[model samples]
Target: MSRAGRLGVGIIGAGKVGPVIGAALAGAGHALTGITAGVDEERVQAILPGIPVLDALEVVRRSELVVVAVPRDELPGLVTGLAEVGAWQPGQLVLHTDASFGTGVLAPAAASGAIPLAVHPAIAFTGTSMDLRQLSNAYAAVTAPAAVLPIAQALAVELGCEPVVIAESDRLAYAEAIAISTEFSRSIVAQAAELLRGAGVPHPGSYLSALVHSTVDHALSQAGSAGAGPPAEALEG
Candidate 1:
């Protein structure tokens, strides 16, 4: 970490989420030391142009903050494997972006004196620059040891996101909610688009885009209000 509090950040994956996140942190003045390309060389170049592509262990060894943005299944093994190799450094901040887990999966790294954190940005990623813009509108679910909880929240803020504290125990519930919403919305959109196409609409997705956005926005705006939805009669019709 620099005296200015900007970290030398390294990323473990260059998949859909990693490079975009590195770009976000870079935007906040953190130095992106390196990233693992993982077959996403094109994406890494596109989003984080000029960042060095290094292996996972090299990335961890080189940085004060390491961001692990691999798939959920891969995270535990990767962290443990890194620990087994003695790659984790004392006082280093190690964070993973998987919504399904909190800091628990990072126990191995923590054992090596690493400070573990979990910060999941609540949005679908396209592995593109558009994700950087979306970060401003998204909330990040942050889980970390209470002593360093603010660090996790600050990192989320640095990514242009509002930070919401999520308890370690509730990480799975949070993941479930995210999964349900995204899957349901995607299924609905696909069905709607199919129906529209069947009805001879030339561009079903484009036609429904505005309507879907407005409807979801309205629903979310009304989400916190009790009895805020349509009346029984409205549903019946």
Candidate 2:
């Protein structure tokens, strides 16, 4: 912790998620120590201007809380490789934002006595300040050792999300639900836009935007109603 209870937060992976996480933490009064450079430097700077671009080791060395927002596939190797280099500091808070993983993926860091946490925000990030607004409506799935569970939940709340406790054993199922919702919405929208374009619509995206939003809103409302579930009968062609 820094002066007056503020943590020195460092972020690895300057991709879509990292900078946004840094920004959110900064908004919550945590000072950003620095962020790793290499991905989208422009977006990183835009989201967190004036924060130094440091190497991963230096970032780890300086931070009291480290945020790892790298891609799902790269997370294990990054944690393990950092462990190999002896980078994890004892007693430091280490959190990753990958839905597919729980703290088990951070065993290497935990072995060095670092506290491991998984707090995956449920949102499709645009890698911009716009995401900050969306965070208020988001739910973060938090998993951590029972002793440190409150820390994870508090951090998630600080990031403007409601915290939902997900057991480490259930991470895969939680991840599948997130992926399915995101991909299905994206695919349906793209297909609709393409069909409109083929039919000579000048701006299919603009044309469908309101309709899509209202339709989805209606469907969600229905799903939330008493005794609601999937339709019993299939639609006729």
For this target, which candidate reaches the highest TM-score against the unseen true structure? 1
Task: After superposing candidate 1 on the true structure, give the runs of residues whose Cα lies further than 4 Å from its correct spot.
Answer: 1-3, 227-237
Clashes of each: 0, 0
Residue lDDT tens for model 1, 1-237: 223887899999889999999999999999999999678687789889899989999999999999999998999999999999999999999999999999999999999999999999998999999999999988888999999988998898899887888889999998999999999999999999999999999999999999999999888878736564443233223
Candidate 1 residue pairs in clash (backbone atoms < 3 Å): none
lDDT of every predicted structure (CA atoms): 0.91, 0.90
Clashing pairs in 2: none
Q: How far does residue 88 in candidate 2 sit from its true spot (Å)? A: 0.9
lDDT of 2 by residue, 1-237 (tens): 223678999999898899999999999999999999955788789989999999999999999999999988999999999999999989999999999999999999999999999999999998999999999998788999999988898899889988888888999998999899899999999999999999999999999999999999898787757444322121100
Most accurate candidate by lDDT: 1
